[model samples]
Target: MKEYLKASSLDEALNLLSKDSQLKVLAGGTDLMVQKHAGSLSDVRFLDINALPSLKNINEKDWGIAIGALTTYRQILNSDLVLAEFPLLAQAARETASVAIQNRGTLGGNIVNASPAGDSLPVLLVYNALLELQTQKEKRNIAYTDFHQGYKKMDLRSGELLTQILLPKGNTWDRSYFKKVGTRKAQSISKVVMAALLKMNGETIEDVRIALGSIAAFPLRCRFLEDFLKGQQLPLLKREELDRLIEQNICPMDDIRSTKEYRLQIVKNLVWDFLKA
Candidate 1:
């Protein structure tokens, strides 16, 4: 690293990023520091933004919930607003490693890291989370589903930084569920994870959103499966039909943690289990 700087405000951070495209912004340092210890960090400058108080707030907005980019996992787990309204997100927050790592892992960092196995990505995708990005010149909102481009890749531009996460009308979800299949329960990264939000009218499904992680290059919504389940009664949802739908929609790849076949099978089971439960 050529230099280290700390931004006192969001504008300061944007100014620095605009001037130096190679400057890496560090929020919690949980992921960045790991890369640094592993000698993976390239020669670049560091801009620490942990002190920016504007980026650590959690407030309810007319759109929905506004989670400042620097909000930590532990904070999310303990937040009454988050737990009551976005239980799936809070559940994902609780399952992120242990208390120690959660204290240092920011929500924005997890999204920006764009890890295939990231526990929060699927939940955000299911809720249709929106990202607030800012630069010295402009500010914009991008859908979370569109933010991720590929493995460890995102739509973030050179002179921009992620500012906040907006959950638009997500609290209106009827029933939300999140499940992660991992080596253990807590500390291990997920091999296959699913997040579902369902709104049912009596026995018929009114609206549904489903997202899966560690089954593709990036966490993605199961739109085909969602479309098939909507307006259908629970009795009409057959296991074999759901199984076929999942197999046709998802594209999983074999990796160090699990096999492609295993991920595919478990994803099918998880979707069924979530609906039944």
Candidate 2:
């Protein structure tokens, strides 16, 4: 028989998790409920953590911002701090889904879902997001880049819950770009997504960070390309050099949403266009 439990407090939730490793956490339920309804989930136990108010806050720190895992996309869209400081993340949040989904979908759910096509992930990668995981015994932080070990897998332990996403204050970036290519403009899964931050010194590229999703097992940072572009004059940078580096970074596959060829070409074109502009 399927069992459901509601956690009255954070302590209660952690206790339940420590005891029952099989309990699937239920937060916003945007993805989980859909899976359950489609019969993908069977003979499962659910731990509803919606009652834990402590997990639903957005706080500013001297170093960066600590976003509670339970903070909904709606809250993110409405936060001025996010808009002014982390506009790339805010733009991704705005493009996540329709208003109704944004109201109910939590950032934590998106992270834990571990979809390669997740819209916010590339933005997080570019920002160098830190994730805080907690259990009854201890708490630890992990870099977002290292959290995903493979497709549909993460570094989370059995009893740990992702509690917060910490984003460090970004350096002064002269240019920022974010784009999500989906079947439709909104409420559609992305076929390919890219986010980039560039610090320019006159015409020379001082520093750059480029990240992409839906083209790899997990969201990827284009470190090879970033390293190649640094100190290169944008006007003189050649597409051939970029194409070579990008090819080394991602391994795309044919999926229902898009073909491998299309995804690869799109990413190359996006990067070229961003630099040229």
Candidate 3:
């Protein structure tokens, strides 16, 4: 590392970020340290914000819940508010690495890392999470869906830091489903991950949101599928139509973990199972 600096406060961190465009913010060090050791970050300057107390809180807002960026996976799993109101997120957090990694890997780190295989990302998409970004001079909020532009790319600006994630409350979902497919269930990275929220009116679908990861360049919401599924009767939903929609919605690739054909088939099966249940 060219430089390593620890920030004691949010203001100082923002100020430092404003000065050095190349300065990388280090939170949990889970991803950063790995990169550092791999020599990928050899010349990067690091600004450690682990000591900033303001970025490590979770609070309930009138509209929803506000989770600080520095909140760890363990913290999310332990949070009663999170568990009760957003169990899908809690489930994702629980399925994240082992206990030690969960304790040390912060949600902020996960979001900023922008890996398509990230466990929480599909859940965040289905939940319609919002992000709050801060700079020395200003603060702004953006929809989490719009945050990722491509693989390993984001809408985050040079001097801004992601501060909080806002998740709107959903008390009316008839059913919610989250599933991750990997070599091993607990510790392995996902080959395909899917999360969906559905609201049913008797047998007809009133509303639906679906998101998927590791089937595209970045984790993405299945907007076309959601639009098609809305107002469709579940029992009458044709498997051919569903398969077509699913294929149109995702762009899976043959990778080291799994083949594109397998990922496509698994996601279709998962969605079918969720709908049937």
Candidate 4:
């Protein structure tokens, strides 16, 4: 392990990363610290980003919502404004490990980790979140769908820092909910998770979004399921239709935590249950 520079400002951190390609940015240090302790720390300089004040805020823009990268899950969960506007996100955040982890684990780290089982990723996907990345040159906003390119891989470049998450505003998403299957409630990791958001026109769903986690290489967002239910009246969307949507959207694999068949069946039931409610 090489001795790394700890920065006090975003510019200072960018300057180091821009100068040396070997510098890796560190925020929250939840995942990184654990990896380092396990002898998996990569040989590189660490650019500490904990001091960037701009990366610790939440603001509403004229067109969208801006959530700073360093904003902890606890802060998000406790935010009344977020609860009112993005209840699905709050619901998903509630299912994360425990209070202690929520107080320290950040939104940026969750996205960067790009885990298939990240509880909040599916919620972000439902919100159509975008990432604002800052570099020495300028700032760029990338769609969340394009941000995570693969498992543990992101589209972010060297010298760039994910500063904020942008979610569109003024859209009515009623019937938004989150569900997850875990061994126990507290501090337990999920075996399968799903998030659904819909806009209703009378009894028909006008627009909808559905995302599933822990069932694929990355959190899967299937707009097709939404499309299928677009014009279907609530009374017409039978349980069989909900079950068919799940099977069509996922081909899950059995893992240490759960069986593929079980996840599929549970996901199908969750959709049916939500629609029925």
Candidate 5:
């Protein structure tokens, strides 16, 4: 009843998309297949692009590092460039589901899925990542901050496919941390997650970036908190001010996984612990 086509190349994929308005791109099929099994998608035309060579590379360029959208979590965990430059991303990848899932789930899929509890989203936000989208006509790059539109929504348009993720290549983060609180140690959705990047001069924080997930409608960057932390010494990080700031900035909703009150407390504790560390 449904048509499944394996794209022979990137061009073929784009052409298929141009022809079939209802066609969906399939990467790892980790999330898409789940939606399929749930009957959320019906009479779907799947354009399989997992084998498209243009979307399967991890390249280091003058602009920064370019990670192909099709790159799997397992590959990211094993990439030397990822380990040396963006270890938090690799750490997030390692925290994703099981080894089997990691081997199949792709970075692009995680991003496009745009789940509030996605582990990698916070890390990507911390890195100020950029996404490359391509179509039969042209290609464009969108900042990660501008990519997510709303709950389970993105800036992606019809006939366009996400091709790569670009992360700046540098040592801006002298100290970094990532933590996720889930129902279980592994294979569970996060109730609250945090990713922090700090650039310090001695004990003074010259720069800082903090991002959180599962505590909001979508992954969020705490620029206000980061601005407050900059040029401040770690020892001078007052708990009262920190708590007040978090309470003022974040208003997490009560969901099936966690309560709003619980999420707020976790945010306070995590920020306090991170500063102390």
Candidate 6:
């Protein structure tokens, strides 16, 4: 038999974790429960985060939109404020697993799960979402890049629960889109996904953020590409330049989802096509 607990408060959750080294945090149970049932991971204790409603809202502040840890994918997609303001976020939320997954999967769990195929990861990366973590000792805010350490690994400590994802005040503007490649559209994991944020001045790109998923150990923003694109004339970057830009930036791998060569080619093509569009 397995031991489980439903903690109704953040303090209770942290206290429980402080006492048990093998305890697992269960928010939506979309990832942890499946992994446990599949025998990929197991725990002596389980702390269900749903009871802590304090962790379940999308708060709009003057600084930014604070996405609660327990906020579901569906909530994000359904938010008119989100759709109106951060279309990039809404765009990525649209690509998440399916209606079923979207209904149950949580934003915090997605970050903690650290899956390479997570659709929202690339979007959050582009928006510069800040990870809010809390424990009995103190609370801290970590940048998204710093929070995701590696595959299934994060900077979160045992007693430190992810409280919220604070997205900086609307960076998304008129030109931004999320593109995903999966086996099939409805309920498939991303084979490879990419997102771009562009501010163009006629034919020249003034600023942008490029992020890709399933291409590295952790999804990351393409600072190199963003830096290179600032005020660059679009017409100058043809197929070869686009290819070289991708080749110079992303270091993709040949995983079960795709070949390294294919990923490279796709990144190059997406950059060129999206910029042109």
Query: How high is the CA lDDT of each candidate model?
Result: 0.90, 0.91, 0.91, 0.82, 0.91, 0.82
In Å, residue 174's CA in model 1 sits off its true spot by 3.3
Off by over 4 Å in 4: 42-44
RMSD of each: 1.3, 1.3, 1.3, 1.7, 1.2, 1.7
Q: What are the per-residue Cα lDDT tens digits for candidate 6 across 1-277?
A: 4578888888888887788756788888988878888987644478787888888888788987888899998999898767866777787777787788889989888888899878889988878779999887889998998877788778988778889999887454558878988788877777788887888778888778888888888898888878888888888876777678778767788888788898888788777777787
Model 1 clashing residue pairs (backbone): none
Clashes of 6: 0
List candidate 1 segments past 4 Å from native. none
Off by over 4 Å in 3: none
TM-score of every candidate: 0.97, 0.96, 0.97, 0.94, 0.97, 0.94
Residue-pair clashes per candidate, as listed? 0, 0, 0, 0, 0, 0
Superposed by TM-score, candidate 4 places the C-alpha of residue 73 at a distance from the truth, in angstroms, of 1.1
lDDT for 273 in candidate 4 is: 67
Model 5: residues >4 Å from true position, as ranges? none
lDDT of 2 at 276: 79
- Which of candidates 2 and 6 is the stronger one according to lDDT? 2
- Predicted candidate 3 versus true structure: per-residue lDDT over 1-277, tens digit per residue: 4499999999999998999877999999999999999999888889999998888998998899999999999999999999888889999999998999998899999999998899999999999999999999999999999999998999999899999999999556989899999998778999999999999999999999889998877899988888899999998998888998888767698888899999999999998988987
Candidate 6 error regions (>4 Å) = 170-172
- Over 4 Å off in model 2, which ranges? none
Error of 3 at 268 (Å): 0.6
Candidate with more favorable, higher TM-score: 1 or 4: 1
Superposition-based RMSD of candidate 4 using all C-alpha atoms, in angstroms: 1.7
